[model samples]
Structures are given as C-alpha cells and as structure tokens.
Target: MRFTLSALALILTVAASSMTAGQSTSGQPPVTFTKDVAPIFQNNCQVCHRPGSIAPMSLLTYEDARPWARSIKQKVLAREMPPWFIDKNVGVQHFANDRSLGDRDVQTISAWVDAGAPEGNPADMPPPRQFPAAEVWQIGQPDVVVSLPKDYIVPAKAPDRWPDILVDPHLTEDRYIKAVQIIPTKGFTVIHHIRTSIVEPTDATLGSGKLDDADVPLEVGEQGVFLNEYAIGKQGDVFPDGSGRMIKAGTKINFQMHLHATGKEDTPTNVMLGLKFYPKGYTPNHAINSTTVSAREVDIRPHTDNVRSDGYLTLKKAARLLSFQPHMHNRGKAECLEAIYPSGKVETLSCASFRFNWHLNYVYADDVAPLLPAGTVLHSIMWHNNSASNPFNPDPDAQITYGQRTIDEMASAWISWYFMSDQDLKKEMDARHAAKTVPTSTR
Candidate 1:
C-alpha cells in the first residue's frame, strides 16, 4: 500500500527514452530481437508468459518468441499484452506494480516484426532475469503454513466447483498478521480463485475434516472478517509498513476454493495458506480493513451494449485508502471508483479499462493515498457490453443477472484501507492538498 512506484515508473520511462537517447533517431536502425525486444519482454511479459505459468506460451527465449512475433506485435499494439487495463488517460495513473508497456516499447516491437523479425547477435543480449520457482513462496518463508486436510478431486467435465474447507490455526493468544499467501499445490492450472476469511461459525462440527457446502457464498451473515484472496497473476498479500490485520485467538480460517475444469481426467489438489505474523507485543499503527461493494441486483437487457450499475458505500469513520480491485463478468467493459466528500465534491480515485480475462489489483502509491472522513461515500460504477460485438460474451440474447457462473454478470469493487483517527486524517489531508499545488508530470 505504502510502497514506492519509482522502480516501475523507471522501467516504463527508461524503456521509452532509451530507444531514442543516443541512437540515430533516423530510420530506427533495424530493430531486432536482441537489440530491441528482449529486454521489454524480460521486464514486462515474462512473469506470466514463462513456463509453469498461466499464459499459453512462453516468451523467455528468442526461439520461443520468434514463432509468435506477429501475434505479439498485434497484442501489444492493441494494448492487450502484459494484461494492464488501467486507463492511462484517466484518474491516478501511477500504480506501484504497473506492468503495462510504454508506447515506445510497443513501437519497437512492431518495427522489429515489420523488419522480418531479425535475430540480432546473441552476444548482445542482456542477462536473463531470475524468477521465483513455480512452487516457491513469492514472499520469503512464512511463520506458519496450513494445508487442506485432504486432497480434493476435480472431475474432468463438471460444473464449476466451489469446495469450502475449514482450517483452525488453534492460536492460544491473539495474533497480528502482516501478510498471508495462498498457494495451490496441484490445482494452479485449473484453479480460478481462492478466498479466505476469519470466521467463528456457530456450528461446532464445521472444521470436522469434511468438505463444506458449495453454496457457502450465499450465506453472507455467517461469513466472518474479510482476510485476503488469491487469483491469477496476483502476488500475495503484504501489508504496508505499520499496518496489520488482527485475528482472535479462537478464530477459524475459512477457505473458499474455486476450481475450474481443465478438461482433463480427475485432478487432485491440496491448497495451502501461509501466514506471517508480526513479532509478539508489537502493535501496528493502523488496522487494515476490507469491504466488497457489489451491486447484486442488476437487470441487463438482451443485446445491450452499455448496461450500467452503481454500488455505493459510506464510511462510518476516517480511513486511509490503500488499494482497490474492480471486478466484472465477461460482458464487463469498464470500472470506475469515485469519492464524494461531505462537501458534495467528487473526486475520481481510480479507473481501469476492464477486461474479463485479466483481473488486476491496483495498489496506490503511499504518498497518493487520500484520507476519507466519516460520511464520505464511495461509488463503484461498472459498464457492460452484452452485444454481438463483444467476443467474450457467451450469449447476446439472454438477460443477465448476478449468479455464480461466469456467464452470469457481477459488479464489485474490493477496497482495502486502514482506520485512522480524525486528527491523523486531517494531517494526511493537509499533506495531500499541499503536494497537489506543486507542478507534477503526467503519467
């Protein structure tokens, strides 16, 4: 939440400026793989495009990329690769983990392909980047790791599975958690998402080593504190400095696993969630909180191109905003978040050009986090396109509503923040106002 984005900004900026810094600036000098495109892929695409990852093909090597040169050029030109959909021309464009390609990089790749996709001298290539192993912990080792009681079998051709498991950490004392990472042992290939919550269900036999009901999502009142979630391309949860989420001593961890079918024979998986606790006796300056604002009630007319819905939430107390994740289904077109202050002034917090396939979490830079006092209402607006023009839309003639399947539509904004006192909130507001008056560069 409070991390610097200078590194990622540098990656985007330098990749743009370096292309024309000392070169002829005349005729482009025959852009080639080693000389032009490799570094761009290394910094931006290899994370998900490599082996054992979610992407269908790897771009880590020249041989791997040569076959897909034209396709790569097309995707990048369309701003579809690297899977970043934040509207660059819209609200707060600087994010901590932005992986979108710069215009210059895209141009470079296009030119390289136009010139027959030449392979420059191998000696000119830079050192290959080192990525964490597929099964290794993204954040270092955790304080404790808990796994599912038994491996769950996912049939080859079945409806989407929502297998819920109960995990009890059995803590004798309250623990302040700094981070949590959920890893799918053998199900990463077919796993859609994994959500965890801290709950104290009244049922005494819940965590009795048996799979819970699949319709657990409908029971909102029984759900506990929102902990964290894991989806494709999401690097686990690591709280900013001086912030933590508390867990009561007797609380049970509820694991809601969403497994998708890969069209293969029975596959088994044992998912795990790792917890990193803060040192004992250390109190955090702020307590992290999360809320999922969803507009469950929606009526989308058949063949509609611009169906819209708005979900609203008004805060009870002051809090410092940390991050946001805007979600929608296949027909989703765009997502936006706005803040309406007590004075009736509205400010755009963040907006992303939504794509159903790539669900991204946008974490704001620490310096940009605004302090919202009581009565500040947050608006989450989502736009959908269920017409024939939308290639991802499964059916353009059926009215859509909120349901558990992907074909059914959903509109939600998962917001994360930390509670702060009024006095501290004022200080943050003052700092934000003072910083705004100064001239700033556009993203």
Candidate 2:
C-alpha cells in the first residue's frame, strides 16, 4: 500500500508541472504590431524616434522596428525609454507629448514581442504619419531671426569650457514677443548648452536710438532684466498666450554658451534665436516663474555609493504650474522633485532614474494643471558618484560644486506658471495691448 501511494504522488506532481507549462505558453493571446504595438509607439516614442530625430534609433515602421522588438519591450517594461520623471500615483499630470506608457500598453508590447512580432493584416494597419523635418522651426515662420554676428571659436584640448557671449541684437523700440526658438548654426558637437539673457543699456550715452553696429557691449547683470534661459535637448521658451517677458528698447540679447570640448581642438559655434510676434492688441494669459535649487558645498565621503544633497523652498502664494524642467550635471547620483501642498497633498513632479545625459524640460498639457496652494514646500534630493566607472567624473578625489561645466555639478528645478486669476490675466493683457509699461520687475 505504501508503494502504491508513492507512485500516485509522483503522477500527480508530473501532471501539475505539465499544466503550469501549458498555462504559461498557451494562455496569453498573441499581440499584433498593426493593432497593439504600433499605436503605443506612434503615441509615445515617435516624436523623438522618427527619422533624423535626436534619438539614436527609429521606430517608424515594423520592418525598421522589428530588430529592436525585444529591446523596446525590455526598456518599456523597465520604464527607462520614455524618459518621464514623474510619480504618477501621487497626482495626474499630463505633458504636451507625454511619453508615459500605461501598464496595458507595456503588456501589449511585451506580448507582441513574445508572439514573434507578427505583422497583422494590412487592412487593419493605421495610416502612416509624417514627421516634421529636422531643424525646422515648429511655428511656421518667425518674425525676427537673430544670429551671432560672428562665429565664436571653441578652444581645442579643453574638454569642457563655459563661455559667456554677448549677442547684441539692438532694437530701436520696445518689442513684445509671443514665441522664441533657438537655432544652432554650427558646432553642434561642442555646444552642449546655451543660456540666453536680455541686457538693457544702463548707460544712456551708449545709445538711445537703433544701433547699427553688431558688436555692442551691454551690461548683463547691471540694470536690465533677465528674460528666459534655455538649455540643450530642450526647446526655447514660448509665451503662446502673449505671456512672454518684454524686451525694452535699447536692450541686447546675451547668449551664454556652454561648450564641451570632448578632447577636440578649436570648435566654432554660432547660434540664432527666431522670434514670433503676436498681433497688436494681444496679451499673454500666463507668466513663467522659476525656482532654482543648488548644492555648492557639501561633504561627500570618498567611495560612497549615493551621496545626497538636499534643498527646500516654500511657495509664498498659490500658483498654477505650466511646466517643469530638471537640471543635473555628470556624476549626478539621483534626483527626486516633488511639491508638498498646504493641505498635505504631495505631488511628485518628477523622479529621474539617474541619467545626466537625458536631461529635459517637461511641458504639461492644459487639461492637467498642477495647482500649488500657499505654504507648499518644493523639495529636491540630488545624488553624486565619486567612483572610477563614471566617465564624466572630473576628479574622484576632489570635491565638486555647482557650475556650468560638466565636471562641476548642479541641481536645479525650474517651474513656469500663469497667474491664478483670469481677470488679472486679462487686465495684464489689456495693459500690454495698449503698449502701457507695466513694471517687469514686479515678480
């Protein structure tokens, strides 16, 4: 009787093993490219994944994408490729071109990869979408195109150098702008980042009328106001609803270019800003406000894996957030950006998964505006790497601080917003339309 019982137990174990294997292999339905995977890629990845885009590869077609099927599946499942830095569980924030993939979308792509990446029926395939040409300005035509007067040379043998350049596009009278776009004329390799500022003439003797000379020297931080700042892998600021900062007459635009030499000698770069103007009597709906967080001095022990630097800022009043941009340099360990509201509702603005090369400004859509009440505290946590494996590490032994160079590190989160009241926005618009001078330094 004991022998019979042992045999029966072995038989049942074999049956269970077979059933598990069958369920694993046969239970999942097959996924198709035309129906499942294509839609996801088209929606999320195609913006930067198309031909001639900044992305390393393309995912426009099944044939072009088939080779990377497994890679796509893995990266999406790992949540690394779409490059979003937000924690969705806290609050719903929708970006203009949101790359966040849903669980269902990920599952569909994974199943499609497992099903041998089948090309579904041609009739069911969606129409192929066309991508805009590279280097083409998105807003059709610009009203004013300002380029560097002369090419600036980048010294060879300098791995990373930050150069502050003054580009004087002298205008006669004050000009109101709606949208601004930056176009890199040359030296794409060495030019890693550019920060543009508007400099108003402090000296009345310098010029009152339109200046004909291109090389005009204007004080940067003296009397004029700083308009907007832009960086690499990001678009220039656009005040679509007539909300951009004004450039007063006799002001010059300063282009502070940050170049990474990359061991090459003497690179020359020229940059241009294409400006779009709003029609007369138009006013912008929103204004942009930025809060910068940095770590200039912090004790980091050698050989430590995750050295952290923290900073916090509390909002004095309520504001409607329009967009967010997170900045970090090489050797950056990790970062968490979030806001704690007055009511204790915490919203995760962005949480980057430790990559310094892919820094970008995340722009949100209209439907999901992250509203911050008064007494909200914005928190930032930055990490650093002082190890040998880091390629961009300037010195593993020495301490680093906040600077423009790649060797030195920085942590900054810039948030842009419009005023809360529609009536106030309209009032500002009416004043701007009348060409009435409202104090730009009010903020």
Candidate 3:
C-alpha cells in the first residue's frame, strides 16, 4: 500500500511541473510591434517625430525607437513630449494626427521597456509605414509657381527695417486659384515680417511699379487688401474658396517684405508662391474665410507684465468652423482661444503657453462638428510681455502698437471658417471650376 501511494505522489508532482513549464512558454506576453508600440508612435509622435520632421529625433524603426524607449516613457509621463497646450480633460480639442499620449499608452510603453523591448515573434511586427517625401505639397502639385524675379539684398544693422519690394508676376490671362502657399528662399536671418497683397491693374496708383528705394518707408494704406501674412519659420497660410483677396486679370502680386536687420547682413532673399487650381468637376462643400477675433492693435505699458488684449467676433448666422491658425510674434506671453455657441455652451478651442519660435497651424479633426448657431461669438485673448526680462522685447521702455516691424508690436488672431450651408459651399466650388474651364485669353 505504501509503495503504491509513493508512485502516485511522484506522478502528480511530475504532471504539475509539466503544466508550469507549458504555461511559462505559451502565456508569456508577446512584444507585438503593431498591436503594442507602432500604433502609439504612429498616432502620438509621428507628425513631428518621424524622419526629417521638426522633432529632433526619429522613432520610425524598432532599432531607432529602442534607444529612445526610456526617454519616450519619461517625456510622455511628464506630458512634455507631445507639446499639447490645452487642458485635455476640460475641452474637446483634437488634432488630425495627434501625438498626445494617454496614461494607458504610456504605461504600456514603460512596461515594454522594462521587459527588454523584445522583438518577440517576428510575425507580430507590423509592416513599415510609408512616409511622404519631404517638400511634397500636402495638397498635390500646384498649377502655377510664382517666384521672385530677382534676389533683394538686405543690409547689416541692429534696428528693424521694413523693405517693401514689388514682385510683379504678370499673367497674360485670368486664372482661378483654389489654394496658395508661400515658401521662403533666403533672408531668414533678417526677415521678421511679410505681408503680400494683390494689386489690380486698374489700381496702379496703389503701388508704383518701381521699388521703394527711399530710406523713408511708406506706410501700408488702409485700402490695400492683405493677400497673405507670414513671420519667420511659420507655415504658409491656405485660403479657402472665395476667402483669398482677388488678383484681377493682368494684375501683379505685390509683396511687403519686412526685413529686420538683426545686426547682421543677410544673403539676398526670394519667395515662391505655389498656386493650386480648383478641380474640374468636383464642387466644394464650403468656402473658407478668415476673420480676426483679437484686437488689431495693442499698447503694452512699460515696466508692466501680463498686458492682456481680448477681442470677439459674433457670427451673423450659423457656420461650421473647419480650422484655425493663431499668429503672434515675439513678446507674446500667453493665449487662450474659445468659442461661445448660441446654446450658452463655451467650446475651448486652444490654450498654450506661448512659444514664439514654434508657430503651428492647429488643424482640427472633423470640422469640430460644433453647430455654432446664430449669434455665436468667437473669442481670443492674448497676453504680452513689456518687462525687462523678456528676451525678444525690442523696447521694454516704450509703449508698443500694432505694426509690421518686429520692434514695434501687434496683436491679432486669424480664424478660417467654412460657410454654414452645404449648398452655398457647392455654388462657390462650381463657380471656381467654371472659371477654370474658360479658354485662356491672351490679350
């Protein structure tokens, strides 16, 4: 009886050991590339962290990402890597390709790093993601490319200088454009501000064809319509349908290049404009338009801090806001943008601790889907620095006003919106397409 009991016990012990070994081999968590980490980087960090992206490092490959796994975990946990400025819990702002990491994602990554970043099970790895080549236009090939006829020289000096140069690209016939993009060629060191305007042929009196060589600069007149405005290292503004200021047939595009002689002579500068035409048969669902919601001019009192300027624009009727871009030069302290709907619900658009060098066009996903009824008000609040410690402060001792030169200050916000009704959008799109169909008239 004793011998039989001993044999049974030995058999039971062997069976238990076999089961434990099987569980260890089969139940180990697989470090899947797609199911685990690739999706995290693709959704949260790819926009700026991919190859040739603005971010300092690339996380596109397992090898490339392995080295930065610890850094990624640390930065994400600290809420610094993604650079999101809004309070995510309170507002519903979402970027088209957002890099903001959630708590669970961060934890998973940290655990993966602790588990040796194992490239476990090669079959579970995802296929490599295809990234677009750099310099390729996001909106496809442009129909017309307009560049400066010649390079303009900029002098070496400390004080800000505004050079109003005329770039006349004389087109023989009328052309309808759907989108326009500006690319800077040179003068990055000295350039501080630029405003491009369309000068109709009939409005020759608006600007003399000859360059403004005189040391005494001419102020931008009130009647002049701004085609586009840009600062250093900023993305080109894209005007929606019927949103751009028109350049009539035989008209010349004029540029007001604001070159701030940063105490050093800069290489000659040139700018290029890529124009995209409306598609042949497709009708646009909405026409894009821009309106300022902040004060046009601001006066920052000397020796003081946190000078605030608030501006609001009430919509005459309901409209769907597609996207918005906020603009502010150096000395910008802080900014908060929001929209108050007719239902008394306030939608927080964006809030950021202002970083002057990094200007981004925050594109929303799904047009925000907010039905801003009649009497909805869009609001923007901008804070400025007028203290001695502000590094970009041109004149901390003097009051500032809205001006083109970098030394002089300005406070303005531009929001681009698509019209309310789908029918109205379709009409504008059809008109644009029809205009393109007409035969070119060479007069």
Candidate 4:
C-alpha cells in the first residue's frame, strides 16, 4: 500500500501508543480512563456530573465518559466545566471546597484524549462512588423546616417578581443554628434567588412585610437581620464547629422570593428554610454574623465594559474573615476583595471571575483565613460588562441602574465572619508567624 510520510508517521505514533498501553514508555504511563482518568472524575467531577445531580451529563463510568472525552478535555483546558472560577494567577490559592482542576489533572485528561481515550484494563477501575438521592438535602434533614404555606405561581412569560412572603415559626425561646439551607420546595428552575431574614417582633420594616396582608409589602433586608440565602451555585451554609447563628424568640422569617418566568407557567412553586440547631443551652465560642459590602448606587451605561463600583467596610473589632460569596445578577463579570491595612499597605486577598449562574461561597481554609487587625478596611471591587460582546448580559442597549430585577444591575458581596478580641487576634497571628519561621532539622 502506498502512503505519504505524514500518514506513515501517524501510523507509527498510533502503533507506539498501542504497544505501550500498560507499561510506561518514559516514566509516564499511558493515560487511560480505568486507572488515571476515573479517579480524577470520581474525586472532582462525579459529585455533580453523576446521575440525579444538577450536572447536564453523567461521567460515572467509562461508557458514559468516553462519548464526551473531547468535550471534557476542552472544558477542563479552558477551566470552565467544574465551575470553580477563581483566578489562579492572583489571590489565596487554598480553599476548603475548591473543585477546580490542577495542572496534573489537566495534563492527564488531555493525554488520554490525545491518545485515543483508552479505557485501559477493566480491573483497574475504581469502585463506584455512592451519593444521596437528588431530593435529599446536602446537609441532611433539619431540625425544623419553615416553608411557604402555599405555592407561588410563576407565569410562562412576565416581568420578574420580588415579593416579601412572611412565614411564622412558633418559638418560645431563642435557638442557635449549627447549619442552615434555603431551597425551592417545588419549582427549582423558575426562581432567580431567595433571600430570607429574621424579623423580630419589633422589626423596623414598614407595614407588615407579610404576603397578601400588608398595604405595601416591604422587603426584609431593608432592616431585618439576614438568616440565609439561596441561588444557583449556593447549596447551603454550614457554620464551623463551635459556631452558631442565633434566632431570637418571637421571630418571623421574611422569605423574599425572586421569581422569573421560565417560558412555562409554574404553579407548584414554594421555598423552604431548613434549620439544624445546636443542642439546647449550648453556647458557641464565637458569635457569628454576616454582612454585605454593597455599592449603594450603580449606573452602567449601554454598551459599556469593565464598569467599576466600590464599597468599603472598616473593622471596628479584630476579625477573622470566614468566606467570600460574590452576589451579582446578569452582566456581572468579576469581583475582588482586598484588605487595606492601617499601615497604608494593600493586600489583595482574593479575586474571582464571576458567573451569574454560579453564585459560590469561596470559603478560605482555616489556616489561610485572613486575620486582620481592627480598622482594617475591606475594599470590595466589582466590575460589570454591558457590552454586546458579553454573552450573559441581558440587554446591550438598555441603561442599567441599581435595582433588584434581572435586567437591572446591583453590586454586592456577602461575607460571613466573626469579630474577635484583640488578644485572640494577636495570639493567632503570633502562632502563624511562628509556624512560618519555624526552623527545620538538617537530619
């Protein structure tokens, strides 16, 4: 048979790959799904990519993954599929729940695909991973579930709706929550966001922010204390051990619902707030709280790009920052959190690329969590893109303002942290310094 030099080289390459299927050619074994790729997917991708999860496709087995091998390689190479969008070029690289792929992971997947995506030895496959059913909560069942008395209807096509739906959970005394979750009890696809807050008996909100009961239904966040929130990528919040959020007695939940029509009328729509509390009379070592550093007024001109907005919060008490959760609607591009020390030094703690679909809480690892002194300024920098080139922007020609709708824009970052005493802060920082400067033995 006649063959060109390029075709001859290609055949020889394939033959070489086939001969080195099991053994390493030069200290590097041939990348295969059974041995190398399966474990990576099992650890990083299978949580969501498996059946009964939010991922669009399943990758639990070679049969399921082989079809999408090329797509998988492309997504990981672009650092897009796993949905952890932190900019690796900057900021603290360690996180408690980071799902992004590492350099070796990318190389392994790429090599497998380029080498014909072999399945390798069937006996080398790892055991299947177990998971809870899709309907179960990630944090397990709660001690109490506060939900809408009835479902809220979402029309097939209409303007987005943000209504203050109040729910009463009878409690004779205060309760300390260990973990909390907010999820749509019925319609998951139609809702845009859900922000729930604790409204005490003497809340300052105008009128009764109650559903279908107040003359003007005011939202809870205007004055009430935040309890928890839910969006696309935010599954729930589990406070650290020995930490809890307090819900006082005689409190009502101002369950503000953000409903957007999904082109199909959804009538069976409701939300549920699940609370798992610590044992009674068990107080926590730290008092936990959360707040947002949000720009009061945001204006984005039509066809604009890299629109910047800034907000600042100075610490009155020494604090250890817990987590950084970026919140923005469509057209939101990127956000950063910086610590401005009183000594005039600025340290960029974390910078992340934002995707409106994934409103994630980037929890800093315990050891790497920033321990800042009092009066340290938390500078929140937010950028928006209103230009047509932006794929997620709702409208390229419309002027955007700071409002609650999907089309309108807002710049806000939700942060969870606890204020610490000066002495505790000093102790923590000194230990960290010591750890860094500790001498190692030559032996």
Among the numbered candidates, top TM-score falls to 1
The local distance difference test score of model 3 is 0.58
Please give the ranking of all candidate structures by TM-score, highest first, separated by commas.
1, 4, 2, 3
Query: Over the stretch 27-63, how does candidate 3's per-residue lDDT look in tens digits?
Result: 7554444468887887667656665344557777777
lDDT of 4 by residue, 1-443 (tens): 22265457655664565455434565667778999999999888887676544466799999999999999988987778788888765567788878788766776787788788999999999999875443456667898888998888877787667778888888678878899888776776666678787777765453122222111223334536566777554567888898888777788888877666766465567887889988898888876766666777789999999999987777777888888877677889999988888777887788888887666778888877888788788888999999988887778999999876677887877776777888998888788777763111100
Better of 1 and 2 by TM-score: 1
Please provide, for model 1 over 1-443, each residue's C-alpha lDDT reduced to its tens digit, 9 standing for 90 to 100.
Answer: 11236646745674665555334455456677887789999888887787756577899889999999889978987778878777665467666667789877877887787677888889878899897555667766888787877888889888666667778878667778898888888866667678777774343332211112111112143245457777665668788879988766777887777776667677787777888889998889987766655675678999898788988877767777788888777899888888888888887777787876566778777776656777788888988999998877889998998765677878878777777888888776676667783112211
Candidate-wise lDDT, in order: 0.73, 0.61, 0.58, 0.75
CA shift at 248, candidate 2, in angstroms? Answer: 4.0
Candidate 1 worst ten-residue window by lDDT: 208-217
Q: After superposition, how far is residue 64 of candidate 4 from its true place, in Å?
A: 2.3
Report per-prediction Cα RMSD to one decimal.
6.9, 12.0, 15.2, 9.4
Clashing pairs in 1: none
Cα lDDT for residue 186, candidate 2: 80
What would the TM-score be for candidate 1 when compared with the true structure? 0.80
Higher-ranked by TM-score: 1 or 3:
1
Candidate 1 lDDT: 0.73
* lDDT at position 377, candidate 2: 74
Instruction: Look at candidate 2 and give me any clashing residue pairs.
Output: 85-350, 85-351, 156-265, 156-266, 241-284, 242-284, 243-284, 333-383
